[model samples]
Target: MPWEGISGLVNLMGTWMTEDDPPVALHDEKAYVATPDRRLVFDSTSQKTLETIRPEGGQPVSTLKRGDRNNAAPPVVTDGSSPLLLAPFVVRQAGTGTQASRTVAELVAADAKTGKVSWRLRLDVADWTKEVTDSLAISDVGASANVAVVTLVKKGSETFSNPSTTYAVDLTTRRVLWTQETFKASVVAGGVVAGTKRKAASDEYSTPTGYDLTTGAERWHDAAEYFNTYLRPAGPDLFYLDARDRAGGKNRLRLVDVRTGQTRQDGVALASRCRYDGVGAVVCWGRDEVTGIDAQTGAPLWRLPDEKAGRVAPRVSSVWHGRVYGKTSNDCIRPRPGVTSWRTGIPSEIDLDQPWSLECRRQGKGRALAAAAGSASPGRR
Candidate 1:
């Protein structure tokens, strides 16, 4: 598809898609464009220029890319009355050979409604010396409340190792809250979880630590015997998955309350993969059953079938409003069931399982319900 559209009436080149990058469309019917020389936003419908930002001599690169695995911290649009846009800019080093140049990563924030730049911060990788060239790349960017969390990974031609660091910035005042050296990090409900491991140390243990989001104070830390660990944030709690227990029998899932640093549920067996439904429940699937767990409290609210059976159970694909949408195997011919309310513990039958599609729509201004499609997934829910 063409990336630029030339509107002869306005003499402007509006952007739809760029080379190897995704379309940057905002809430107010505007699209963002970043060329090698300039960055601009234009109206999609009218093809009129709204704002333009031209860097002096650096290349203007778009942070919005489709299927970008390199950037762990991608651009994010925060939720509020006036949304904010956080983006990254990369300035290519001007040189040749291994020690000729270094790359710089810049983080910029702007008001989404108006294309005004709020604040710009330059992330320094290391001291640039004549001997060695140093470079840095943004790995991740996550936000919660009024704070923006960023992770920068070091990349260069030198043989020395450079550890990544995570920084928490206050969006209101544009001041940095705190920064810590860690390998990986994520923003949780009330804090940030950072994973740290030593380089080339045989006996070094990897520790996942939690820090306060507002003040960046150390709240809690969990040291693991093994290095392979995963942390997932769901609501007000953090789920720690320890793979060391897999050797014993089953994997362990630890649910820790982010506020008090207390382990609410420890050493729980994980049957299968689980994910938050964005409503108020964590939907998980096991061998032949699907279960819903309350987010606030780590209690299982409702289980399908209500009894153990060999029948293939439906797996939750998406949840919207108050209904859960899932699909079953083709061999199972039983009608699909729906849970009326997780709080009320009621069950009802909706329709039979389709081959591969699921959809949901509102009925006469009522709640949304799941409906089957022939070959596509749910449209809304």
Candidate 2:
């Protein structure tokens, strides 16, 4: 499902892209380097690494007591005067008994130059994860410049752990704004969280609810009792929820605006995965074909298998800036890697001679496409 091999940098000028040699060729994991001064640092797990960039009197910060352990999550880089570095650190007093350890945690703020804690706030770890871990820690973090959402997960199987408690923090004031009761969050964008809620106590909650990411207020709910339980975000305020009839007939999709709920409902069955090109089109790939729909009107834009199937339809790698870049599905023949316009469903004239890798900006922009790579390729969001 992922592209493996070398990475090549190409610049798109319209219908053509000129290839260029990149300055560095690190593997996906080691593709980034942080710089405080003129020197380059790898940001290893060390207190010294934080003192690269900073501000004058970095503000009075709170500290974990002499024996308290701060289980910190990864830091999220954002723009603002809050702090050069912000991370959710779960601080706990040492103990080894039932239900593990401490529920105390802190969302920390600091400057890169001094690594001094600009501020810290106690976090509320959900009761769901109490029995799962002997200690509390932030598993992952998602944030904008002003708001941050941290996921506290439950012990899961080999595949992955599910989120139990999600906390939204105000980055500016270093305050815990609100908490969402989401067992699993699908997507968070434009201050909206769309995910499955814990209606009662069981983990079998299928109804996906859209909540205000900033305030954790319930905005809308989608019934996903049977067929499917996924919602693809079309915009900050708009998302597409499956509203198909369980009885039979043609499946339908409801385009919902979190502000007022349902906007436009269409009788179109989108693929299992869909990408909303920030523009006005939503490109989707069903099992055997690719389709496009106008995000606003919910009208069908185009679909593959209409004559030039092999040349246009790709395996659906990724959609960015309104273009879908992917390798052709019919690889048995000559593999044609192309970029198709999600709005038109027509393949671009540009040909990616090196189809070895795909580019995804997960951590930061420094994460380039790994060329001539290995087992782990660059991640996609």
Candidate 3:
């Protein structure tokens, strides 16, 4: 199918056959079904069952046989390293308030064909007081070719506050690469990891830090990427940085490329959120107007309201390949869909640097994009 649509009058027609299978972790043409005790592997298109793994029931291991409790929760996250699947079974060992509790992430590398365990590497994620039983669970993850990041946050909550820990593990080196406090891993690609961090002291513009994916060295930490409005990577090297000019009372969107070490500023006037269309555009969608930013360049390439000031586009949520998919406030009453071509640049809007400024081109209700943009990306083994 083509990427763009010149008009906004499309709607989904019908559905297809569905399954009761739990969400599959897709890697290449193989789909892995992982649970706490059992696993299944099958072909994606052919629907051929490849393997099934059942529990090896036995006595508790020697370590857990003692008084300590061992709970290897379900494998909520899984990745593929070719013939082996990097499935993390987060094991929590409860401890007395005085002895301290322990959490171990035993990444089992199971062969895809035989469903046999090829290797295993266990990492001591964190130790906490008995009172903090579930706060240090692995909530998010990001993995590249060799390095994998596991993010720890409160068990039931989504946002990480106070002190969140994200650890990078080197599968080849068989060790934890580095650990960051008050940091959450977002994207790991192009030999770099990008994520937002809570400032150690102050607020306002939060921390944007980067590190070499292989070397684990501090790479980029710019003040322009705000913690509240974190910019998702348009490409491996392309992401927006909101640079505020205090004296001028305007904010310049600085487009920073980690690969070429280049920085270009544009007044794209994007607020709230942005996501890679998984294609060539970084779409900023929310509220009334939805704008598209060219990933290669920092310029806004398109806007909802055309030169004739058309009604605002749907509160765009998903952009895959190039087409925009979302719902408008009128969905309850009347909704329409549309698309457009490329190369046409989006208009720039300069937001006030200071707070307490309100300008509504149109008063329309909308839902912000998902808070965790590019949170836990599985990597190639």
- The sequence of per-residue lDDT tens digits that candidate 3 reaches over residues 45-105 is 7767666544232211122222222222222233443545555545555577786445565
**lDDT for each candidate structure:** 0.48, 0.47, 0.48
lDDT of 2 by residue, 221-247 (tens): 755442344455554455666533444
Error of 3 at 318 (Å): 2.4
lDDT per residue for candidate 1 within 257-371, as digits (tens), equals: 6556566666442434455545676655556655666777777776765555433346544443354554443321122444434443343544433422212111112221232
lDDT of 3 at 226: 46
Candidate 3 — which residues are off by over 4 angstroms?
1-25, 30-85, 94-101, 109-118, 127-131, 137-141, 155-160, 198-205, 223-231, 240-255, 259-271, 307-311, 327-381
lDDT of 1: 0.48
Q: Give candidate 1 regions above 4 Å deviation.
A: 1-75, 89-91, 95-100, 114-117, 126-141, 153-163, 191-205, 240-242, 245-250, 267-273, 286-289, 303-311, 331-381
Top-scoring candidate (TM-score): 1
